[model samples]
Target: MTREFTTPPASAEPLAAPPSRTNRGLLICGALAGPVFVVTVAAQALTRDGFDLRRHPISLLTLGTLGWIQMSAFIVAGLLTAAYAIGLRRVLHPGPAGSWTPPLMGVFGLGLIVGGAFRPDPALGFPPGTPKGNADPMSWHGIVHAVAPPLAFAALVLACLVIVRRAVMLRQLGWATYSAATGVVALVLVAWPGQDGLSMRLAVAVTLAFAWTTMLAFRLLPPAG
Candidate 1:
């Protein structure tokens, strides 16, 4: 009788890493949240007369909460964007990826911060005649609000372009395509007439779109597969 060698059962430790399903879900949620917040803010701005911040203190309270959420979204998005950069660093030419990383993320983060400062609040209300504040020629917040979107868009555009280029070089077709599409959509949305225009309604819509896309892209960075 041949003595059959008994192989020990596999150890409890995983040999291969598990897929980041949870991470992916978190990313999707974050992305969706950004857009949702944007839509909420925009809706409020559009219906400013209807939204009495003073009478319904709850609504004011709600706006404050949403603002925090918006800020959180930016922080999360920046982190995710950084992670994507790291992944790209693994595959791309050292010099370009290295050079692009800091400034790209730096500006993106700056956009979020500045954008936060400029975010319109009907509750606080800007100087008279400046609807959405970004359209306000006289007020400083208006100018900041006006300029912030473009700056944020520029940063995003750069980051996305670099990622796409690196993806192309590395022959990462899927990653490249997605990055490019996201970048393009974001750029277009930010630069669109609605955003670029001085119209308050359009500006609000564009800003919302910007926030949404940024969140969506950032979330995808972690577990897009």
Candidate 2:
């Protein structure tokens, strides 16, 4: 009897090992991070006694009697995102865009945790008790709080670009365009610090960025085999 050899079909990406339950759980956390954060911010922005998304940035929610709520939200979201990054490596590895994306995402997640740990100084008359025009002589923690978001945003933008490259390589023009748009728009929003609409702009940027992350996580989720 004669035996014949067969080969698998050609593809852009190599098939990854099947994901275990732990990895699936991590991806689920990644998917939930966006909703958990966006909802917390929206609900607090709408319900807080003096909070106003039009004027007060979401960071101010980390102040006052209800401060812990926002703080917890940030930390939780950060943890979820970090876990997702770990899971992302499993599926994205041995492929394009795998080198920098996961580390960048981890950096972004760390920034969130730092921002939560070091709350910004109350400003713009938020929490109904602070004077306007920023806190005087800014606290060290406040400075760290100020620095975290931009750094985090920068990392996210870089990660977006990396993914865009991957998408283009795979001939996924639509996904590439979407990733490019999200990255560029987010960068612009982060750079602009206008007094009139800073809060609104940041809110939109945050929602958009996290939405993209959630979408990416779902798209990369391994199939049942």
User: What clash count does candidate 2 reach?
Assistant: 0
Residues 1-225, candidate 1: write the lDDT tens digits: 688894423321111123265544433443553454456555664554444422322112223434464445444544544443333333222444446744565565566556555544443333223244323243576466547656756776776677677567656677668777767775664455632232433344345445634543453344236
Angstrom error at residue 157, model 1: 1.1
Best candidate according to TM-score: 2
lDDT (C-alpha, whole model) for all candidates? 0.48, 0.86
Q: Assess every candidate by TM-score.
A: 0.49, 0.91
Worst lDDT run of 10 residues, candidate 2, spans 8-17
Which of the numbered candidates is closest to the native, going by highest lDDT?
Answer: 2
Tell me the lDDT of model 1 at 56.
28
Residues 1-225, candidate 2: write the lDDT tens digits.
999995543322333435678767878888999999999999998899988898889999999999999999999999998998887787777678877888899988998898789999989898797897789999999999999988998999999999999988888788889999999998898687556788899999999999999988877765545
On a 0 to 100 scale, what is the lDDT of residue 175 in model 1?
Answer: 63
